[model samples]
Target: MCGIAGKTGIPVENIQPITDSLHHRGPEGSGYYADNTLQLFHTRLAIQDLSDAGAQPMQDESKRYVLIYNGEIYNHTALRNKLPEISFRSHSDTETLLHLLIRYGTDILEELNGIFAFAFYDRGEQQLILARDRFGVKPLYFRDELPNAFSFASELKTLRLLSSSPLSVRTESMLECLMLQYNLTETSGFREIERLGPGKFITIDMRSQRRQTVSWARPLYTRQYTVQTEADWIDQLDTALQQSMQRQLLSDKPVSFFLSGGVDSSLLAGLTKRLYPGRQLDAYSVKAGAAFVQEGFADDYAHAVSFAQQIQCRLHTVNAQPDLIHDLDRIIYALEELQADPACFFVSDIAARAKDAGQDVLIGGTGADDLFSGYRRHQALYYYNALDNIPAGLRKAGGALLKMLPAGKVRRLQKLLRLSLAPPNERMLQSFLWINRSEAMNLFSADLREQLTLDTIDTYCAGLLAAIPEEHDPLNQMLQLETHCFLAAHNLNYLDKIGMAHGVEIRVPYLDTELAKLSALLPPQLKMKGSETKYLLKKVASRYVPEHIIKRPKTGFGAPIRSWLQEDAAFRENLRERVMQVCSQWPEYFDRQQVERFYNDTINNRTDGAYTLFALAAIESWLRQFTAN
Candidate 1:
C-alpha cells in the first residue's frame, strides 16, 4: 500500500526522483526524511488510517526507529495483545509492525503473518533492515556497492533512477528468461538491480557498509496428520480459505474481485457474496471481441457472465479490442520489462479500469492453480507412476521421438516421459521446459553469451535442490520447489508489478500463510487424486459453486497471441522488424537466420510460435528502450 526508496551516501535531493517514479503506488500523500548519512522517502496510499497518524515515514515513540512499509498486517490485533506495555500511537498496522520489530528484533518477521516488503531504519542501532513476506506478495529490489553504499526500493526502476551504472542486460538472466520465460532469485533483465528473495531478511550496517542475509520465515512441511482423511482435508481447506477471505476483505475503500468464471474466481466471488450480502461487490471480467483470434481454446466470456449473474454482484465486463493491443508498448514500459506475456496486457487494462473507477483493492485467484495442482501438466505424475516399469533409456528415447510429432501432442508426451524418468520432486521444474539451454544460447549473440558465466543454470537449479529435505517424497519436494522458486520468483513478481502499476492492491487468499501451511500437511494424494488435479479444492468448492462450474476445463486467463500473430499483419510486421533490428546490433550473440525462421513461421501461420515470439518481442523492446539508449 506504499512505495519506499532510500540510499546511503546519496543526497536527499538525488533520491527524491527515485521515490517520485513510484508515485502511482502511493498517490494519497508523500514524505521524505533524511540526514547526511541516509535518505528515506515514502508515498502513502492511505488505506489503514486517513488521519495524519497513518502517514509515513512513521517513527517509534522514542524516535529510535523509522519505517516505510508496504502491505497489511492482518494479525496486528493479535500481536498487540502480546505487547500491552508498548503505548499504541496509531490505529494503523504500519505502526504495529514498527513497534513489533522494536520489541522482538528480527524475530518479528516469523511471528506476524501478512504479505509485505518493508525497510526499517534503526536509528539507535545504526542499521537498515529489509524484509519481504514469506510468499513474496510484495516486491523489493536492492543494489549493493562495495564498502558502505546501498540502495533499496519497491521497484527496479526506482533503483535504476539512483544507480550510477548504465542499464545493461544480464545475459545469463536474459537467457534464462528466453529459455524458461522466467528468472531465478535476485536476477533481473537489468544487470544492475537485484530482487530480494522471499522469506529472506537482510540487514545493512551503515557504519561498515556491510550486509547479511538470513532466512527468517521457513515453510514447515512436516506431515502431522496420521489419521487425516480426504473429507478432513476438504473441511480444513474450506475453513482456511473462508477465514483468509474474511480477513482480506478488511479495507477502508471499496474492494473488488477479478472474475474469470473458473472455479477459483467463481468460488471467491461466491464467498464474498455470502459474507456481505448487503454490499453489492464489484466483479470484473474481460470481454474480448468476436474478431479476436482464438489460440488453442475458445473464449469463456459467456461463462464468466453467467456466473456473475448467478452471484448477483454488479458485473463490469471490459471489452478487449484491437486498440488495446496498440497500448502494449506503454504497458511494457510501466512494467519495466517486456518479459511478461500478452496476458499481462489484458490484466493491466483491468487494473487500470478498476483504478479509474476508484476501487483500490482487487482480490485475485492466482495462487489457486499452483497450490491445488490445477494445471493439465499435473497429470504427468500419474502417467509417470504408471510408466515406472519402463527403462530410463527407453523413456528418454521415446520422449525424443515424441518431440517430432505435432507440437501440442508432442508437448504432452514429452511431459509424461520426462516425469517418468525424472525424480518426483523434479517433475515440476521439468514441466516448465518450454525452451532448453541450447535454444537459449542460440537466441543470444556470441558476445553476450561469452559475457555470462556458463554455470548460471547449474547454480540456479542447485539452489532449488538444496532447499528440499533429503527424506522428502519426490512429489512433496517438487511442490516445495514450485512454491519457493517458481511461484515466489516469477508468478508473484508478475502480479506485483502489474497490480501496483495502477495502484490496485491484489490479495491472494489461496496463498494465505496459515492456509498454505495446513495444505502442506495434507498428503499429496489428496491434492491430485488419480488423473484429477486439485481434487480436494474441487470438493471444497462444490459447497459454494455448482457442479457444472467446477467441472469446466481449465481456461487460462491469457490472450490469444497465436491467432494475433497470424492475423494481425501490422503487429506481426512491427514485432518482427523490431526484434531483427535489436538482434542485428548484437550479431555476435544471435543467429539472424534462426531469428528470421521464428518470425516467418509466426507471421505465415505455420505454427503456434506465438509464445516464443512474444518472449523475443518483449526482450527486444526492453533492450531497445532501456539499454540501447
Candidate 2:
C-alpha cells in the first residue's frame, strides 16, 4: 500500500505540499512527475519490492505513460507471464501495471484483481485515467473544482490542500453521518470534494478538461445465481481460500493477522500458517478489560488465545480499555469520516501497537460478512422473509400483541414489524439506519429543522435502495447493499484510514477479486442455511479452524460503548462535557438544549440511545476537528 496525489493544470510546487502530507502512508520513498498538464506524486511503502526500482511515478520504457498508484496487485506475476516480449525491470506489481497499460490501455482493469486507486497519465494521448478497485477497499478522493485545476489523493485530508478557502460543511453529510454513522453519498463532509465509487474509472482529457466515467464492474446482485452441489461448492471454496491467502501473503516484510477468535479471522490465520509452514507467523488480538465487559458486549480474548495456541502462532494481546477523552481528537481527525463503530478506535490502537512492534503488513478478514450473511441482522431478515408469508393483518396484530412484553423485546418486535411492512427497497435501509426520520426530527431543534429538509434523508436512502438489483432474490439485494454501502463505504474506509494512520498496511484476503466473484455466485441459501450464517464459509473453515471456533456465535469486534456511557461516571461526564463544548463552539449545526437532552438521556439510561449518542459525539468531534478553525 502507498499514497498517490497529483493535480492537473497546477504547478509542481503547489502539488508537493499535499504529497508531503501523506508521509504516514508511505515513509520509505517518494517521487514526483510534473509537466505543464499534470503534477503527479507517489510516496512508496515498499512492500513487494524493497529495491529502489520499485519506486513509483514510474514511467514505461517509451516514457509515454506515467503511473502514480496505491495498492497491491495479487495477480501481477500471472499478468506479466501473458506478455513475455516485454522485459520487466523489477519484481513489482507497479511495473506489471505499467506494462499492462502499455499493451491493453484501459481494458486492463478487467484483468486486474487487487485493491487499488491509481492515476495513470498517458503522455501520448494527454489524458488521465483514475480508477479504484472493485470494492473501494483503497480510498481515492478528488477535489475537481480547484482554481484552474483538479486534484486527487488517497485521503480527504490531502485533497483539502487544493483549496485555500475555509471548508464548507455539507448539512446532508452531517445528517447522514449522525444517522448512519458514515456519509451515504459520494460527496464527503466537505462540499468541495467527491469520491470515486467502487469498480469505476474515469478518463479526463487534458486538452478539453472533460471527464467521462467508464464502468468496469457491477454489484454482485446483478449477477445470476448458480446452483451447485454442496460438496463441489465447498471444494471450490477451500481452493479459493488457499489461493487468496497465498496471494495476499506476498510481502517482503513480516505479515501479522488480527485474530478476532471469530471464524473469519481465525480461519485466515490458520490458512496463513498452513500456507507457509516454514515461516514464523505473528498475530495480534485485542482484549477489552474486565470493566469494559458486558452481557452482550464481551471480548474474544479467551477464544483468540486458544486459537493462537492451537495454531502455534506468536500472539500479541493489547488491552483495549481506551482513554477515549485523550484519544478522541486524533481518532476522529484520522478517520476523516465519523464512524459510530467504536471498533475503529480498537483497530487504530492495534495497528499503532503493531507498527511499534515492527510489523508492516497486517492481514484481516473484513469482507466475508457482507459477501456471505454473517450478521445477526441477516438472521432477522431471514425470519422476516418467513413472516412475510403470514397475512399482513396477522403480522400487524402479532407485533401489537408483543407490546405487553419487556421493553427490549417490544422494541425488537416493533423493528421487525416496521421492516416487514416497508417496501422491498426500503427494508434494508430501515433495518440499518441508527435513527428514523421521526426520531431525528424529535432530536433536532426547530431552527436546525428549517435549514435542512427531512426529505433529503428519504431521497438518499431511496437512491441507494433503487440501485439494488431487484431481479435477484431479496437476500442477494441485501448483500449488494451491505457490500456496496456498509462494507465498502464504511468498514473498508475506516479500516484503510486507521491502519494507514499508524503506517501499517492492512490486506483483506476475503476481498480477493477471484474469491469474491466465486463467493458471489453461491446461492443465498448456501450462504445462510436456515439460521446458520456464513454456512458455506464455516463448513469450509471447519477444515482449518477448530470445531468449537467454527461453531461459536458471531460476536463481531465488540466495543463497550454502552457500558462506558452508562457505567463509567467520569467517562460519561467527560464525553458529555466534550459534546457540549463542541456544540458551544459550532452552534449552527446543533441545538444546545436538544443536544444536551440527547446526551443526558443516553448516558443516564433514560433511553436505549447509547449508539445514537456515540454518533452525535463523533459528529461533534468531527466538527471540532474540521470546522474549529
Candidate 3:
C-alpha cells in the first residue's frame, strides 16, 4: 500500500510539499518522476517487498512506462506467472502491473483481483491512465479544472495542496455529509474535486490536456437464484471464501485480524486459523468497557476471548471507549473528508497498536454484511416484502392507525408501520436517511432549503435501486444497492482512510471480486432465511466458527453515543456548546434555533439521533482543517 499524487499537464515545481501531506499513508520510502509533460509523486509503505528493489514510481527497463500506485494486488504473482518471457527485476506487484499493461494494455484491469488506485503513464503515448479498484477500496480523488493541469491523489487534501484554489464547501455535499454522515456520490465535499468512481479509469492526453473517462466494471446483481441444494451451496461458499483468504494473505509483513465481536469478523478470524494451519495469528478485538455494558452494548470482548481460545490464536484487546470530544476533531481531520463514524477513533487506536506490534497488514470482514444479508434494514426488507402481498388500502390504514397513536413505548412499532406503508423507492430512502423531509427542512435555513431540493436524495436512492436485476424482490434490490453504493461510499471509505492514517493496510477478503460474484448469485431466501440474517453464510461458517459465536445477536463497532450524550453531563455540555457555537457562525446553511431544538430532542430522548449531531459538529472540524487553504 502507498500514496500517489500526480498531474498530467505542466509539472508543479514543488510537488514534494503536496506529496509530504500524504506521508502518513506511506512513511517508509518516497520518490518522484518528473518530465516536461507531467510529475508523479509516491510515498511507499513497502508491504510486498521491503527492499529498495520494490520502490515506486517503478518503471520497466525501457523506463517508457512509469507508475505511482496505492493498494495491494493480491493476484500479482499469478499475473506474473503468465508473463514468462519478461525476466523481472524484483518481486513486486508494481513490476507485474507495468508488464501487464504493456502486454495487454487496459484490458488487464478486468482480470486484476485487487484493491487499488493507480496512475500508469505511457511516456511514448503521452497519456496518464488513472484507475481505481472494482469496489473503490482504495480512493483516488482528482481535479480537472486546475490551470493547464489535471491532478490526482490518494486523498482530496493532497490535491488541495497542489492548487491555490480555496476549498469552499458544496451545499449539496454538505447536505449529504450531514444526512448520510459521508458523501455518497462521486462528487466530494469540495466542488473542486471528485472521487474516482469504483471500477473506473480516466486517461489524460498530456499534449492536448484532453481527458476521457470510462467505467470498466460494475457489480452485476444477477439474482440468478440458481437451483442448487443448500448443502452444495454451503460447500461452494466455503471454497470461495478460503481462496480469497489465501490471496489476501500475500504480504511480506505479518498479518493480523480484527475480531469486531460480530459474525463477519468472527467468521474471518475462524477461517484464518483453520485454512492457514500452523501459522500463528494475532487477532485484535475491541472490548466495550463496563460503562458501555451499562449503556446497552454486550460484552463482546468475552465472546472474542472464548472464540480465540478455541482457535488457538493470540487475542489483543483494545478499549472501544473513545474520547469522543477530543478524538472526533482529530479523526475528522485525518479523514480529509467529513465523516461521523465514532468507529474511526476505535479503528485508529487499533491500527496504531497493531502497527507498533510489527503488524502491517490487518484482515477485516467488511463486505460480508453488504454481500450477504445482514443488518436490521435487511430484516425490515423481509417484513416489507411480506406487507407488499397485502392490499395497499390496508397498509395505508395500518400506517395511519399507528400515526394516530401517541409516541409511547411502541415507538419502534410506529417506525415500522410508517416504513411498511412507504412507496417502494421511498422505503429504500427511509431505511438509510437520518431524518424525514419535514425534519431536514426545519434544520436548514430558508435560502438553503430553496437551493437544495429533497428530490436529489430521492433520485440518488432510486438510482441505486433501479440497477437491481431482480426488480420485483425488495430484498434483492436492497442487497445489491448496499453492495454497489453504501458499502464503498460509507464503510470502505472510512476503513481505508482511518486504517492508512496509522500506516496499516486493512484488507477485506470478503470483498474479493470472485467472492462477491458468488454472493450475487445466491438466492435471497438463503441470504436472509426467514428472520435469520446471513443464514447461508452462517451455515458455511459453522465449520470453522463455534455455534455459540454464530448465534450471538448482531452488533457493530460502536460506542454508546446516545448514552454518552444523555448521561455524561460534562461531555454532553461540551459537545452541545461546540455544535451550537459552530452553527451560530454558519447561519447560511443552518437555522441555529432548529439545530438547538434538534439537540434538545436527542438529549431528552424525544429523538433517537446522536449521529445527526455528530455529523453537524464534524462539519466545523473538517472546514477548519481542510478549507483554510
Kindly report which residue pairs in candidate 1 clash with one another.
148-209, 425-474, 444-589, 444-590, 445-588, 445-589, 445-590, 446-588, 446-589
> Which pairs clash in model 2?
none
Best-fitting candidate, scored by lDDT:
3
Residue pairs with clashing backbones, model 3 = none
| lDDT string, candidate 1, 1-629, tens digits | 98888888755465557667989889888988887678888888877777889899988878889999999887787889878898887788898998888888888788667889899999877999999998888888888865667888888778877675566667766666665666775677777788888888899888888899988877545545335777877787888888888878877888898887788988998877877778787988888664442444446677788877877878888876534345656665766643645667667878888899999888988887777777666777677778898888988899787766655325556667867776754565667655555555666666666676656755676676666545255455556666766677667776777888888888888888787777777777777889888888899889888787888777666666655566777776766766686578767657687778766754654433567766776666666667766
Q: What is the C-alpha RMSD of each candidate to the true structure, in Å?
A: 2.6, 2.3, 2.1
The 0-to-1 C-alpha lDDT of every candidate, in the order given, reads 0.75, 0.81, 0.82
TM-scores of the candidates are: 0.93, 0.95, 0.95
Tens-digit per-residue lDDT, 92-181, candidate 2: 999899889878887889789899999999998999999999999999888766445788889888877755456688777767766777
- What's the C-alpha lDDT at position 46 in model 1? 71
lDDT accuracy of residue 359 in candidate 3: 97
The order of the candidates by TM-score, greatest first, is 3, 2, 1
TM-score of 2: 0.95
